[model samples]
Target: MTFAAQVAMFSKLAEEKGMVNSLEGNLSVIDRQTGNIYITPSHRAKCLLTEEEICIVNPQGEQIGGTGKKSSEFFLHEAAYKARPDVGAVVHCHTPYLSAYAFAYRDFETPKDTFLSQIFGNIKCLPYGAHGTHEIHQGIEEALDGRPVALLGGHGVVCVGEDLEDAIGIMEAAENYAKTIAIKHKLF
Candidate 1:
């Protein structure tokens, strides 16, 4: 599948799974060979995203292809790529369970022996960085130094992987892990 198509497919799946809402999330994958980034558009609903609507930006954040405007949070994705060359895709999700920790400014201190730890390895919540501004994405590289996921302080969650499938897998796993923790605290 094309890179744009892959992003659109995962964006819709993210919406269906409640990892992202109609207009609150973004997904992107880079063409490692060409350095082109296929990303979701700004102000559009992920549930209804189309491959044609996916925007393409060069490594320097210039619009190189596609018809739609790139997401405002593009810096966040750029930072991840710069920090981890091994990552090919990035997903920004506003998932409920995961956002709970972000909103509370708390980190996910998963036990080292747990399955979630294997996936997230203790998610960190970075300090508040206003969305759409450079400040918001600052320190992201350091936070993701050796982790696949991190909670955006007072914002949402960011997950990365070798591709869209891997990125979203980390995202879904993190959400489910967060949900389990919430339920455990409530009932126990």
Candidate 2:
């Protein structure tokens, strides 16, 4: 698939899975040959973004193409790529279950059920940082070590994978398990 098509497909998947709402989430894929990162634009609705709307940015976070601004929270995605060379895609979403944990600065436990447990090992909730700032960049860098998924304190969730499909699937499974746990806690 084309870069924009992959992003649009993943963004739509995230939205359908309840991991994206409004303009609260973004995805990025790195061009291995050119090293340019293509990220979702900041101001568009999750479901409304088109392939041509994706923004290409350099390693230093400078915008090179696409209309409008790159995601203000681009640093989170950038940091993931910088920290893990193996990571080709990053997906960030302000899904409700993850957001609840993010707001509380709580770590996520691997679910007791085998299916759910396999989706997450341990998820760290990084300390709170203001969005689109270096503070957030530092937090993401510190929390992303040795894990494919993490919850950003008071922000949302960030997941890294070999590609967009892997990244989005991990986020979807992780977030759904989180929501299930939340509902279970309410019952018990």
- For model 2, what is the C-alpha lDDT against the true structure? 0.82
- lDDT tens digits, residues 1-188, model 2? 88767887787777777677666888989987888898888877767777888888987678988775788888888888888888899998888887789889899887566766755667889888898986775655656777788888888888999999899888878878888888899998
Best by lDDT: 1
What's the C-alpha lDDT at position 34 in model 2? 82
Full-model lDDT for every candidate: 0.87, 0.82
Please give the lDDT score at residue 159 for candidate 1: 89
TM, every model: 0.95, 0.90
**RMSD in order of candidates:** 1.2, 1.9
Where's the lowest-lDDT run of ten residues in candidate 1?
111-120
Candidate 1 local lDDT, 1-188, one digit each (tens): 99999998998898888777667889999888988889999888888888898999997779987778999899888888888899999999788888888999998888779767876788899989988887777678777989999899999999899998899888898888888988999999
Flag regions of model 1 displaced more than 4 Å: none
Clashing pairs in 2: 102-154
